[model samples]
Target: MGIPRTPVRGVAALAALAALSLTVTACASEKATGGGGEASAPSAVGGDGVKTGPGVTADKITIGLMTDLTGPYASFGKSLTQAQQLYFEQANAAGGVCGRQLEALVRDHGYDAQKAVAAYTEIAPKVVALAHVVGSPMVNALKQRIETDQMLTLPQAWATGLLGSRAIQVTGTTYDIDMINGVDFLTREKGLKSGDRIGHLYFEGDYGESALNGSKYASEKLGLTLVEQKIKATDQDMSAQVAAFKAEGVKAVLVSVGPRQTASLVGVSLAKGMDVPFVGSNSAYSPQLLPTPAGPALLKDFYYMTAGTPISSELPALKKLAADYTAKYPDTAIDSGVPAGYSAAAIVVDALKKACEGKDLTRAAVVAAHRGQSAWGEEFGTIMDFTTFDRPASLLSYVAKPDKAALGGAVVFEEATTSDLAREYRVPVG
Candidate 1:
């Protein structure tokens, strides 16, 4: 289960990678034009006769996205995509990025890494960058392509195993760091005491294990007892797991699986008369959880932690996003994932503008612009320089309690916070 982790690139490695991108771009240009001068490279309209990258034409700059539109995490994927699509549309209406309108090319991986990799392969050569890549499992599968292909990806998952590649950009805290802060919040606010029995339900892959490591570390540090169980990301029933936790009389539960698993655990436990708090990791929450039959049950005991501020936040950036979203799609409900998509688009837009400033836009130019950033903000949190191998750019998460009145929306009670354990956390790079 212990695969070697990837290490982050330092300044020298980043420059080397950037140079690789440029070199690949040049080679691709040569190949596409039959040894002609400056062809297949993305070029500016009315300025140059040469193109720079795969998906950039004079009128549009396309971005590729892979997500679970019909799989287990379908709700989050759908909502995230909606936000991204609408945001880009709004941006284009006012003024396009670098004089070219932005376009989103989407593919559904159905939560399967194999399919995700295939989809990525099919679209990798047709876009300037990846606008969104969902799921930790998908990221695990795409690691090599990201590192070698210079296909910059904006990932929704924050597992540490996928953090090493400079091509993949993470916008939030790693699952491990989020859990450390999570446990700290539990101990301080929920009166979770030393020696108390806690249960964790997680998937058996990188994403789940990343969060489990945090809970295990937190238990050792806080003098608490952790009883752990593993499940698959696609698990739909958890009666046995609930029974096991019930038998052990765990005071609270922590989950690192998807929303279906979380719902099953909470619902089954309640039906069995073994009720307890079930705190969820970012991936374990979705707005769809509220309308389910388990909604009432969750209202009694569910809590969630997110690496970014909620879409409902009063911050100006979030306010503009929420306003734009509602104006475009008035009937659609909002969730934490919407802001995530919005922030990622903002970052991509920022980078694209920088990369295209009085120069031809290329994938390498985007990479260089991203690496050159000393400080970056998506209006949700500060992004650390991945070029420096800062594994977790930020080590904080916002904790929220469910609001029954709003159905699925949560009232964020705590701002993103970091504990001493989180600040010093480290994980292996594959």
Candidate 2:
């Protein structure tokens, strides 16, 4: 998953039933009670006058976050998790949804499919909804279970294959959409032209494949040749891939892998003097990489696309978020994940608030509330329309380049905008 930039602004796996041991982290706000020392009465309740369901109680609501920590994407996950915790803390301070304190049940899957399943199975019965689930493979592994429970889940993934599921809401543009816009940027701004060969280095699963689909569509639409190179999440060395692209004489490269792989690819390519421009999906970059050996290489020719505003933006919401987060986590480094996580939690809170209005906090009611949202706006990014599940909430993407001195280590070069080809391209549904 990637962070947001507007003009900035901003998968699946199978189930393995192996014995899994995991730690469940809890982040909750101080409990609040009525003036007379009685637990606050719920603003509304179900028809039976008792509104209760998994993770929802008279005085508290629990939401689950399944993310990657101590894994390849740990940097992204840790920052995202912290931002969500911050949001929940603020919400609780302001009197949580339906007059109940909000609690976040966080479990780290370490980006492993089996661990993700185990974590979900353990937390599913204790949460009203999922605020965030990271990794396309992890989400894909739990897709059927999520649907069966009718749980409203916000995945930190953008693969198009994850679409069409009412229960799984992808918060922003899909990976394909980002790539479509990315390809356009290369042609229109980076000096690539029609008939030029474009190489794509992507992971093998839904994340990469879905992004590849977009590049394929863009190439076909604009008369470019796409050279494909598929890699695994575990693959780090990109020397061979760079050699191949060099041989193919590709003018540009699109990446759909994680930050580590991105570093390797760019660093190796630069070392070999393969100075072509590189664009990546949101998942392909991390602020943590700015200090690494590949930092210079990435800064020179690497760009990424996302659906949210960058943390360095002058947007008021983003500024406030940065200030609050810095105060809360004095020792932590701010990154794109801060906005990404906060935006996601904001969406979940919106749904919960809507559900409260109807006097229902049941899992099904929460889902309904989320589906009712249309043209929902967030200060950190573009407007999102969630009434439908077949396409992205927004199509606009921000093009950004890594900046060593910037907050989140990135600065947007192209504000949020949609390419004509992207607008015309049909989004594939599962």
Predicted structure with the largest TM-score when compared to the true one: 2
- Candidate 2 has its poorest 10 consecutive residues by lDDT at 8-17
Per-candidate TM-scores read 0.85, 0.89
Clashes in each model (backbone N, CA, C under 3 Å)? 10, 21
TM-score (C-alpha) between model 1 and the true structure: 0.85
lDDT of 1 by residue, 57-109 (tens): 77777877676665555556656777888778878998897778888877777
lDDT, candidate 2, 320-410, per-residue tens: 9999999998877788878989988999999999988877887888899999999886677678989999999899999988898888788
Worst 10 residues of 1 by lDDT: 1-10
Model 2, position 130, has a per-residue lDDT of 90
Where in model 2 is the C-alpha error above 4 Å? 1-50
